[model samples]
Target: MDTYSFLRQLADSWALLALTLFFLGTIVWAFRPGSRDVHNDVADIPFRNETVPVDDADTPDTGAKS
Candidate 1:
């Protein structure tokens, strides 16, 4: 009922374990190894190749200019 009893009860409750777990999880996550260039050396398969021509009309004549 008093302040001292409340403090003592809180110190022994599951709140202490929860707080410890939270802090431990935070430290582990903060110092965990991170990825380096995760997409590096990765290849993508594009459905369409832009380098190929779709129509012959767009090409210029290879004959003489005259």
Candidate 2:
């Protein structure tokens, strides 16, 4: 068997199976029990950012009349 043929067969079979299993595992991990708090924290990150006060020192002065 030539190297190209062997690699092609391996990719067509094992690679496909590996990718499918990885996808399913990710889905299972995402929806598993006892993960609600972590997911909630991630979901609230945008709202948390809004609550933080911005420091004036970080702002640049435009040096123009308002």
Candidate 3:
């Protein structure tokens, strides 16, 4: 019944359960209903800058000309 033994037992039991519940809760929250639009917007972030067409010929060529 010493401090170290008590802490070890509590951590091995309640702490483990708490962490597992927190992980499952996070998974549930991420896939919850009515969040598809928000998720889609976030997923499109990388392509946001690509919406405007880029013409390479019109841009300057910074390469050294031999």
Candidate 4:
């Protein structure tokens, strides 16, 4: 109801504490170290390679050229 009471109530509450811990966790996670080696150079890339369907119906005639 009054300034002192309101401020005392705020001081005892968890909102600021929760906010501080959230920021600290964010900072710690950001600084946590691990080398990504050369393999992870691209973050969101999808892997592409040797898997392909070889069904006869899907084949392109090797002798034909367009």
| Best lDDT among the predictions, by candidate number | 3
Candidate 1 residues 9-41, lDDT tens each? Answer: 988887798899999998877566762233332
Provide the lDDT at 10 for model 3: 99
lDDT of 1: 0.72
In Å, residue 18's CA in model 3 sits off its true spot by 0.5
Model 4 lDDT per residue over 21-56, tens place:
999998877666763533365543564454676688
Worst 10-residue lDDT window, candidate 2: 45-54
Q: RMSD, each candidate, Å?
A: 11.1, 5.1, 2.8, 7.4
Per-model TM-score versus the true fold: 0.37, 0.70, 0.72, 0.37
Per-residue lDDT of 56 in model 1: 81
What is the number of residue pairs that collide in model 4? 0
lDDT: the better of candidates 2 and 4: 2
Q: How close is candidate 4 to the true structure, as a TM-score?
A: 0.37
lDDT string for model 3 (1-66, tens) is 999999999999999999999999999999999989999999999988786666799889999999
lDDT for position 39 in model 1: 30
Lowest summed-lDDT stretch of 10 residues in model 4?
35-44
Q: Give the TM-score of candidate 2.
A: 0.70
lDDT of 2 by residue, 1-66 (tens): 999999999999999999999999999999999999999999998887576666889888989977
**Per-residue lDDT value at 35 in model 1:** 28
lDDT of 2 at 50: 70
Candidate 2 CA-lDDT value:
0.94
